[model samples]
Target: MTKKKQNIIFLLVVLLFTVVLIFIPTGFENPSLHKNTERVKAVITAVNNSDLQNHGIVTTGTQNLKINILAGMHKGDTISATNVLMGQKRIDKIFAIGDKVLAIVKTDNQKILTARAEDYYRISIEWILLAVFALFLIGFAGITGFKALLSFIFTALTLWKILLPLILKGFSPIVSAFAIIVLCTTVIIILINGFSKKGLVALVGSISGVGITCCLALLFAHFFRIPGTVQDFSETLLYVGYTHLDLPSIFIACIFIAAAGAVMDVAMDISAAQNEIIDHNPSITTKALIRSGFNVAYPVIGTMTTTLLFAYSGSFMFVFMVFMAKGTPLNIIVNTNYVAAEILRTLVGSFGLVLVAPITAIVGGFIYVRNY
Candidate 1:
């Protein structure tokens, strides 16, 4: 088949998969839970904070709001809504008059009963931010940026539509995650690099590195005695009746899944570099090509080695701050599951990054240089 024909077919398959995912039912969101509630956009006309009380920096109690509905069946209706505070600043919101809010209006037979100021109506701003990002990407990188956006959407849909659903359906989290990674890795590399040696080498090397990371995570997690409950909200899943889940396995899956992107990046870098070298100098021996690939990889691996640490540490910075504020001992902190889990994530992810470089280089030497 022609290369152009292959690209057309690949895009069509991706589009079909995306459409299917959009309409796929995971059986979890059976809207009966919120059948009587309708989300509406509204402006807070007035806020009565008389019932609210201050306890330290956190506020607890409720603010009664008079909201003028701007959309939905309740349009033009003025209703009273409650914004409750639970003394947790992180999850709490304080709204002033004239602020736009998302109002959850409860109704039976189209008659309004109660309303809640659920949160700010920030969806508009979120869409605007996304539009800005899309514009910048396409404007700068043109066709390649557009392809990257499609891959980004595909990855997100696969995680939400396929990966999480399978895990929730009692499938093994480790297997479910790996399958999604492979699916994502294949489509993304192929879509960007097309049906060629570059894509093939990158895909193979990326998966290999991810596999190594998964093994290390599971093996070290056992030695580290990570109960998996250490992951944020993992225990909450058990409380909410997903007792069938193996949290430790899911935690292990998360380590490699997080690392897979970095692995793919390194692999693609080496593969693309080797392919360019071989194209420029066809007589370049596989050994010389391998040396050149390694030279290209060394600088990338240096920067990438600390990339996971920065990303993982940023997510848990507040937790680290809390520990510091409490003056926790370094020995105790290191032994704690929180720090241990972060250690596992950083090290395993970095290991995958390091492994992918040489794997891609060695694989690329034979595949691209020798046309194997």
Candidate 2:
């Protein structure tokens, strides 16, 4: 078949696969054993502060809230809900009349026992924000932007549906993560650059860089002696009955997965530059094209290395501030497990960025320069 026909077929296959993924269940639904609990949206009709009181060192209070259920089986029914305040501002919320909120209703033997206020109803706003993002993405980039959005959706579904479920099923985290990264890199690069020499070079370079980063992460993590529990919620996973997981392996997997995006970026940069060089001078030698790719990659590597540092450090800015406030020594802070983990993450990812340039340049030279 012709190239145009092949493109159309590829697009159709992608769309079909995406649709199927959308409906596939990840087996994590309704894993909660609490069958009597139901979450519903409700609007506060009235608030009664009759139970408000101070009890010695702590203030114990309850707000009697009249609410009309907006959803679920009891929709349109008005019920009495209790908002408990334990004097902790972080967990306590005071509901006002006419406010929409989420509530957990407990029922036993088909009789409603009680309802508790959970939080403010914010799903509407979340959907609105998502819509705005989709609109702007498609509006700006047109067809390519639409494909990028699809790739985003595909990546999310693959992670949430396939990757997470596989890990939960006791698959090796390192192997699973590597497979997902390769899949994502292939689809994303092909979507952006099409099924050409450019995409192939980028894919090869990206996978090679990711492989190197993964190996380095494992090596450094082992030598550094940082446990997987250094990551947030990692310990929680063990508490929740996933004690079989290898936390250190998972943490090592995350390091390279985080760096995969930057690796792909460097690969694409080199590939695109090489493609352009070949287009301009069809007779250019492989050596000359490789040098051109290096020239394009050097400046990009500088900013990308710092980009990884900033991206990783920005998340822990508050932690850094707290350490400084307590007059902690820089050596102590750097040696901490959490700090060391971030250091590994940033440096390993930067290494991927640095290495992907030369790898992509070499691959691009072989692919783009046909006379080599």
The estimated TM-scores of all candidates read: 0.97, 0.91
Point out where model 1 deviates above 4 Å: none
Per-prediction tally of clashes: 0, 0
lDDT of 1 by residue, 129-210 (tens): 9899988998999977877877888898899988998898899999999989999999999888889999999999999999
lDDT of 2 by residue, 213-258 (tens): 9989988888999899999889999999999998899899899989
Q: What lDDT would candidate 2 get against the real structure?
A: 0.89
Model 1 clash pairs are none
The models' CA-based lDDT, in order, is 0.91, 0.89
Error of 1 at 105 (Å): 0.8
| TM-score of model 2 (CA atoms) | 0.91
lDDT of residue 303 for candidate 1? 98
